[model samples]
Target: MKKKVGLYFGTFNPIHSGHLIIANYMVEFSELTEVWMVVTPHNPFKKKSSLLDNHHRLEMVYKACEDYPNLKPSDIEFGLPQPNYTVNTLIQLEEKYPELEFALIMGEDNLKSFHKWKNYKVILERYSIFVYPRISKGLIENEFLTHAKITRVPAPIIEMSSTFIRKAVKEGKNIKPMLPEKVWKYLDEMNFYK
Candidate 1:
């Protein structure tokens, strides 16, 4: 049987418990065989400098997902062009790994603004979308919903965020439970966000 791969792309600045929980839930509750955390080099619309170094962010993701066989950190975007776009990434992934089926995994928050993505219609038609809810206006009500295979995974809405974590670290606050132990150690050793 062919493996169903879910691409959970993000700028995992410092992989936290919330991400892990969602990956676990996706694997357990969905038909996906693996969830590849595609570490984006840069988000086209967001400020690149705001994110941690790509290598550092990738390393943190690797540490956080080390225990889970189903979770992995992908640096596919590293070799790709600057300001990586999802459509291009997906197309490359499909061409490179023809045997495995791919699905786009994202939060409902992203879905609300997904139409702004370049070739959003092509994305909706080509791949299945797995949406997890965040603290937002709830699931997106869009025209794409009618044609897209959208699955709502029951992922916990953790109030923690990379922005909040970074702010806390800069202010000398503790983040013991918010982040994975290995990731925390890495941040401490590297003096990141200081």
Candidate 2:
């Protein structure tokens, strides 16, 4: 059988326990054979100034995922053009790893706004999406709720946010418990977000 890979895209400004938990859960409990923590170099919707250097963020993801055999860090988006779109990345990944069946791992919150994404319909037609629960207020598009390509996974709802983590670090708060031990050490040594 072809290996099934779930693409978990994120900036991973500093990968935390919440991110690790979801990726680990998806790989172990879902149909995915592996979960790739795709470190996004730039998110078109977010400001570049607020993001850390891409390599630093990738390193953090690497450190955070090292202990999990089924979890791997991916830099595939780093070489892609600036302001990359999900559809484009998916196409590239499919071309490069034709032997693997790739799927998207997203939050319920993202699913609510999935329709607004560039070429979202095309994405839905080509690949499956694995949605994890999130405490979101808005309504998911009724169509997405019943879409054949979308699968809702019963993963724990982790409310932790990278934005909150960055704020805590800037304030010199003890955020060790919020991050993986290795990630915490890397963030501390580098004095990021302070």
Candidate 3:
């Protein structure tokens, strides 16, 4: 059987525990062999000014994921063009790692805007999607919920945010609870997000 890998794409401005929980839950509860956290260079919907440099974000993810054997930190987008889109990224990944069958992983809240994603139809038709939940939107019920391509994993809603962590960091507050020990230490030593 082909290796089943779940791609959890995010900016990971700083990879926190919430991200690990979701990625961890997916691997333990689903058919995925491993969950690769794909650090995005930039998000079209988000402000570029608010983002840390892609290399920095990528390194932080590497630090955060080092302890989890099944959780990988990927810089796939670093080689892609500016203003990258998901469809393109997926295409390139599949081309490069044709031996692995890829699945898309996202939170339930993302389902609210799933249709707006570029080439979403092709994505749903070709790959599987694992949807985890967030604290605010613990569950989602819709026609898409019944779609064969989508699977709602019963993972607990993680109640943390990178924004909240960043704010706490800037205010000189300890955010150990939201981050991995190594990542928190790295951020503190580097004086990042201040």
* lDDT at residue 36 of model 3 (Cα atoms): 94
TM-score of 2: 0.98
Better by TM-score, candidate 3 or 1: 3
The runs of at least 3 residues in candidate 2 whose Cα sits more than 4 Å from the true structure, single-residue gaps closed, are none
**Candidate 2, RMSD to the unseen true structure:** 0.7
Ranking by TM-score: 2, 3, 1
Worst 10 residues of 3 by lDDT: 134-143
| Candidate topping TM-score | 2
lDDT tens per residue, model 2, 84-130: 99999999999999999999999999999999999999999989999
Backbone clash count, each prediction separately:
0, 0, 0
Clash count (model 2, backbone only): 0
State each model's CA lDDT, in order. 0.88, 0.94, 0.89
RMSD (CA, Å), candidate 1 to true, equals 1.4
Q: What is the lDDT of residue 11 in candidate 3?
A: 90
How well is each residue in 1-194 modelled by candidate 3, as lDDT tens digits? 99999999999878899999889999999999999999998888998887888888888989888888999999998899888888999999999999999999988788768888999899989999998876553445465779999988999888888988888899989788789998888888888889
Ordered list by lDDT, greatest first: 2, 3, 1
